[model samples]
Target: MATVTTLAPQAPQAATRAALRTALRVGWFAAAVFWTVLAVREGVHHGWPAATAALLFALAPDLALFVGLSEAPRTARGQLPPRAVPYYNAAHRALVPLALLAVHALAPLTWPPVLAALCGWLAHISYDRAFGYGPRTKEGFQRG
Candidate 1:
């Protein structure tokens, strides 16, 4: 006797969720490009200080890794210490820099360096999200 087997179909909910995730990733990548362009434009127009600020702020988010150095026992390989999760999440959130940019725009004196910093920060956040990296859980692992 011959037996025929059919592949299991993915659930509708799962397919919808997957499509939404892909859409979000695409949006993030587009935001990354937008922020990067703004950062480079400000940096080039405003000279070294703006450029320097952009470079430094772009890398500043990962500096949260130092937050729990003294509480080393809570950390493990490929994970952050529980103490650092809050700091990491705060640093990685796009809202923080967005707020800063709004404030800068409304301030009496707008500074190119501040604009560069905000753009750089947003670019970093956007790129991370675009590449599937996001805030950690309270237990310090990447959220699913």
Candidate 2:
């Protein structure tokens, strides 16, 4: 029942924050392509096992925005409680994976699987951001 002051908070109520269904589908396809390319590249260099592990991190974070128990907010329509908006934004943020990358770069871990997973997160976020899907507003709408 919570709602943001705006359509998605970042824009006015009249803004076209909702993407058309067809556009959503196409955006998904683009995301898949983005994931595939990165996964493939990781597989080629690190082997399938690493790629497999990497896949674990791939869509999970982004998916977390939309997943909730019956009483929780539904991110699909950006209908989460106003207080929960920050959680969705955190899930959609690139800070964690980027931080991992920075740490890896500075520390140079020998673990390929960990690095691969980090890459997957980066790739997934990249895909979503690339196609205009971003953190949801409390009003259950995206700024697309």
Candidate 3:
């Protein structure tokens, strides 16, 4: 009788990485829920203008898609346009809206609609992160 042997799979690292990725996604999802609740609360407290602002700001970042639709050349179909990469990245960063919120906290005046907008923006970014969407590379492709 002949005996055959096979090498062990080297999937531990891969498994670990996948687990971490899942944990990160869950964290982002939790943040999304928190921010969404806050946004809704702000809009409810402040009325129609704030609600409208929140709704608009939530969808604003995605408007970057329109840039890809323009005449600018792309590396592939459905890829973001190079011209729009900067705009999309900037809008998607959680830090921008966070900084705005911090500024709002410190500034002398109160703007309810702006606060609502910031909350909406944070919710949008958090949801994107949760779904594994993020800033694209300069080449207009998803970064690894």
lDDT of each: 0.93, 0.68, 0.89
lDDT of 1 by residue, 16-133 (tens): 9999999999999999999999999999999999999999999999999898888776567768888888999999999999999999989999879999999999999999999999
lDDT of model 2 at residue 35? Answer: 58
* Residue 144, model 2, lDDT: 52
Instruction: Give the Cα error of residue 108 in candidate 1, in Å.
Output: 1.3
- The superposed Cα distance between candidate 3 and the true structure at residue 106, in angstroms, equals 0.8
Better of 1 and 2 by TM-score: 1
The segments of candidate 1 whose C-alpha lies over 4 angstroms from its true place after superposition are 1-10, 70-77
Write the residue-wise lDDT of candidate 2 on 24-65 in tens digits: 657666765765676667767889777886787786775554
User: lDDT score of model 3?
Assistant: 0.89
Provide C-alpha RMSD values for all models, in order: 4.5, 10.0, 3.7
Which residue runs of candidate 3 sit more than 4 Å off their true CA positions?
A: 1-9, 72-75
Residue 113 shift from truth in candidate 2, angstroms = 1.0
**Candidate 2: residue 50 Cα off by (Å):** 1.4
Number of clashing residue pairs, candidate 2? 2
Q: Sort every candidate by lDDT, greatest first.
A: 1, 3, 2
